[model samples]
Target: MSIPPGESAPNVSTGELNARYDKFVVDLLGVIAYGELSAFERLSSDARYSPTLHDRAALGRMAVTEFEHFDVVRARLAEMNMDVELAMRPFQPSIDSFHDRTRPADWYESLMKAYVVDAISGDFYRAISEFLDQKTREVINAVQTNDESGALLQDRLKKMLADDPRLASRLALWGRRLVGEALTQAQRVGTEHSFLRGLMIEDELPAARNEVSTLLAQLTKNHSRRMSQLGLTA
Candidate 1:
């Protein structure tokens, strides 16, 4: 409950005194947890796009890993004495909208989401993971990382382009849109959150304003190189 007119309770328990610490833990983790859930749904639904048994199994395995992360978040919330549903509710719309509006049409597109979109998300999450406390750090580390899929993503992008040169241009455009949408979503949250805005600024120095731009530029260049290997436009 909120503090009474003349009386006050601390913003967090004495045990949880770091306001920014607690905020980062709750905000960043909740977002990551929601992503796990969405990934599960997207992969399960989109696996049908795959033409081969091996591709379908790979996507299913990725979805299963995402659900595993979801389970970790569920248990972590209970330990924190917070309601998981309450922590998760406000995020449903935004997360749902992000995945919904970017549905992939084929197997390649699905892997692209798993690769490009998920990699950028990992970059963002890793940024906030540093601010958390010990237990929080352990939890963050325990949560899933996409190293396997990430490696495969790079390999597959090269092979796809080598096999069909014309596929490169279309995939390049698709990658650009995917990155752009993710940045727009990020910009939406950054403007709406003072703590995150401050933290991002703190993370960058003389070029704080250009930090995200630079990161995106790097992502685009990497994406473009991958495209070129496929004989696609940057």
Candidate 2:
């Protein structure tokens, strides 16, 4: 069932807990944990396509970073008395669908995918974290930070764009396609997962609908800014 806009998370007392909201939190953690794990796999495979030893090493480092983030989330799940792997299982279909549909065509495409997709995912997570408790929010924020790969990808793309201005249009199109597929899969997850959809409904009052609208605007703005930073048209 879905909550109306602006309804506070269900309250429980004494021996009771808000099971629905707690489940939502667990599901969020699961999605992110599995996302990181999948990222590790994808990045590792992408490294095999790197043109130079240096580039491959850089991708390898980024893969390790992804696994490290996955471990952190797994630890958090353990603290919550949840089965980490089981919790992550429900999220795999959507996350995997996103990655499978958007697999990069080459080394440059992989770099663009890493930068654009990661930034978009990060912004989306940051927006959702606002609805969570302080501890959970902190965990999500820490997991969402873009790492050295972001910087390396930005620099590489900038140089490439500078050297061949025509490449910008193609990469820009790829970025747009990435965002489109991501949104498609995101909508599927939201529809299939009631608790996740509930998180967006800030309260029961009709006026609270603005919260979701505001959130969408914020995500879009952050995305446009990142695209600009990468010297691409959003």
What RMSD does each model have against the real structure? Answer: 6.3, 3.7
In model 2, the worst 10-residue window by lDDT is 8-17
Local accuracy by lDDT, each model? 0.66, 0.77
Tell me the tens digit of each residue's lDDT in model 1 across 1-234. 111122323443433334444554576667767878888888888777777787788778878888898889878977877666766776788878887778877777777777777767766655545544567667766675657876766786677767877776677778778887887777665555432433332323345446555655665566566555545565
Q: Where does model 2 exceed 4 Å of error? A: 1-17, 195-210
Candidate 2 yields a Cα-based lDDT of 0.77
Prediction 1 TM-score vs. true: 0.77
TM per candidate comes to 0.77, 0.86
Taking the tens digit of each residue's C-alpha lDDT, what string does model 2 give over 57-94? 98899899889989989999999999889999998878
Clashing residue pairs in all predictions, respectively, total 1, 7
Error of 1 at 26 (Å): 1.2
